[model samples]
Target: MDIGKQIKTLRLGKALTQTGMAEILGVSKSTMSNYERNISTPDPDTLRKIASYFDVTVDYLFNDMTDSPRDIIKEGTAYHPDKALNKDEWNAISYYRRLSDEQKDFIKGQMIQLYQKSSSSNKG
Candidate 1:
């Protein structure tokens, strides 16, 4: 696993500067640079600190996976690469994501009722 690359990716993903991360970790900028550049490796204590700061586990930091923030999808989100949604559908999704829990439940109930009505109409 490329630990240096993982650290660099996490730091850049958070939009944090090397100097800023260095100060946060109580290390020198050169040390941070070195860590990112694969010139030196941080001890276990520092690894824990970095993991905590990045909201990731130490194993993840040292793991072979190339993690990126953009690659992580939010929960309850739907993604269909084979089918593209229309603008109205996209807008509805955006609006739904911004709605409160109660509003979502209300909308869901309304949708279920609409679907039932449409089904009955078609049956007739």
Candidate 2:
């Protein structure tokens, strides 16, 4: 199912009104309605919040799974993806993706050196 449909189904399964979800998510009721109706996609932070609230992964939110949306609740918890990446990590990734190839190579080398230094220090 599409993300909007999935969100609507999850909301209905939990018996939560759009207003209640908006309040909890710190968005306007109309914004919540837009999300359910697929008028707009949630930003990364809000997407993370929704996944965390439903105890599902960000990948689950993006993927089309079972024919039945309710199956998400039953199987969702079982399919845990990696722990949610934090804002700083996500920002770092976004910055990395925007870099030129040379910049990326430099950054990657720097990261590897940092990692090796930190690892050796920890062993010592």
Candidate 3:
């Protein structure tokens, strides 16, 4: 199960510090430290809250789920077997994730335009 490892993985995946996560959960920093270090287990309520906050099931936290949601989403996305997305692709993805809905649409439009240009060039 390794709940502590899963918690550490998820928290780090989300780029949240222990203090930040503790503040969100209304727990002391030491408590969060304890949970991540496997020194102490969080109560059921806290566990549920953590699961909810991370948008994962409680079973996932307790079970052996090796991949984080971010890893799953970004996996093989860039099409290079040796690695995931390259620096430019990674940068674009990271920035796109923070965009507003309208901005996202605009980016999609730009992508369509690029695709069209490439398609036309290929035909020529």
Supply candidate 1's per-residue lDDT for 96.
85
Lowest lDDT 10-residue stretch of candidate 3 = 67-76
Give each model's clash number: 0, 0, 0
lDDT of 2 by residue, 29-102 (tens): 99999998889988999999998877667887876643523222124568534344554664476468668999
Candidate 3 lDDT by residue in tens digits, 1-124: 6888889887886799999999988899999999988899889999999988877778878875554232234345553334444446745665786789999999999999999999999999
Model 1: per-residue Cα lDDT over 28-60, one tens digit each: 999999999889999899999999877677987
lDDT of 1 at 50: 97
TM-score of each: 0.55, 0.53, 0.55
Better of 1 and 3 by lDDT: 1
| Residue 80 of model 2, lDDT score | 32
lDDT at position 28, candidate 1: 99
Task: Write out the backbone clash pairs for model 3.
Answer: none
**Alpha-carbon local distance difference test for all models:** 0.81, 0.76, 0.79
